[model samples]
Target: MAFTVSANFAISADGKISSDPQRPSGWTSSQDHKRLLELRRNADAIIVGRGTLCADNMSLTVPDQTPQPLRCVVSRKGNFNGNEKIFHSHGGDIHLLVTNAISCDFERDSVTLHFANLTDFIETLHRDHGVKHIHCEGGGMLLRALLDYDLLDTLHLTWAAHTLFGGTNAPTISGLDDGIFFSSRHFSLVEMIESGAEGELFLTYQRNDAAK
Candidate 1:
């Protein structure tokens, strides 16, 4: 089985995913809030980087929705705090993907840990869990790794012009290193919707091959 990844994010006009000084995505318009829930509704699983999990403290729950998608977290070092809401959520499965380069001493009945490469990790989602469509909410680094490897298939972006989080170190949807580039991993616009009169945009992008 082949699994496709779609990333969702709301960003400031400055192209920062979140505030440079550390702020969650709650600063966006209410339209984006609805968009996010709708995105989650369509996904078979929702994935986030460990940085995002810690920074945002996401609830990872879908209300009034049957068969909630799996809540997945990825970490290079496998560092985590068990107090996260995802761990204690009432329904759905919690999964953690840890890389082979690090050691993760943490374990819990609520969380299933996968120690594998990125490719294998994704394959297991489709083969073992039957996750056909994956929604990724990122902290830049994880998304960067996916995009750099041509693993990302789509992007759902919300551009909020009213906000600005200024800092050179601030991250965007992708947090690639200074010299890395994936020229072939291009995305074409699948849809664009203007959100009222707030100078906000809801844009959808699919890979050049997948846009059809």
Candidate 2:
């Protein structure tokens, strides 16, 4: 509960993470990709929803770094694809948090599965694994859940203005188009950098303690 959680995302000018819901977010510049790796390097663990993991074919490994961050994947029923790139990649321990009672028998030496709610799983990561900082690379709904739980501590965003994903159903940063509402979570901008050449903007925000 005391650990820090930071979420990273790259959104188009229209506030969409991807042109298509299932498409990988590879539209950002190489500079943004480097920034993503840098963020991963600083985390004790990396978390992603099953959807994002599959969509992007993410390996969740920090390149050339010893003792990579723990790779964590969460799903409602633990229906993860064992064939996904993350499973075969070299990285720290893999933790699968299943929120439902549905059994996940993903057998592997590096993989450890847990059936628990998100809050409890996070607490276990902190209390048992000594995870002090968690970096989340998301596909929207997962980020929304973290916000609803008041667990997000920091936000890193790359605003890619060059691409446009114009559609009424396009998902925003929170993917909250279902009319379900949560209280406003306030964050203060801590850093901002303009990359005019790349047509992108990098921003970092810290959750406002007063709001909590």
Candidate 3:
């Protein structure tokens, strides 16, 4: 409740964010990249699942913006290689949120580590760190957790017609183990930008909580 959480992703017409064996989403257009950067520039913090960091080596950069947004990575086990680019590439602080279920020590001067569940983590981000807006660039599992917790307020999706990544192992935004956990959540279209002649659609949806 302390922060407005937004999730963003690009998917193929078949509803796959990745191809076989969890391939990196390198096929997305430059336009999508620009939009991602724009979101980063406007937010107070950026979040990514640990799987996304492992798969894409993301830096979460906010170039040309003063007081760069904090980069946060969430992991259940607090597991990470110290040499990843996310550690060395950003100009702002990097934090790790490892659940109290994890007993592993993840403390260092280079990064601040917090032990909290997702709910407590959001409160801490708002109260202690003064973060009001958070944008999540996902790897699916994290998106499901936010949705199930009723923490997500908005979603940005891009539908690409030319690409078809059809694989059983591929993931969409919410790959919940228990299907329909978010059946009560409702979202309405807020905006749509159709790319000219490419059959590409950039869509924004906001959860309709105020309506009901």
- Which residue pairs come into collision in candidate 2? none
Structure candidate 3, residue pairs in collision: none
Q: Please list the C-alpha lDDT of all candidates, in the order they appear.
A: 0.81, 0.86, 0.81
Cα lDDT tens digits for candidate 1, 71-115:
988888787768876776675788899985555788899788998
**Candidate 3 lDDT tens digits, 133-212:** 98899978888888888888989988887898886778888862448873678899999998876668899999988221
Clashes of each: 0, 0, 0
For residue 137, model 3's alpha carbon misses the true position, in angstroms, by 0.5
lDDT value, candidate 1, whole model: 0.81
lDDT of 3 at 147: 84
Highest-TM-score candidate: 2
TM-score quality measure for candidate 2? 0.94
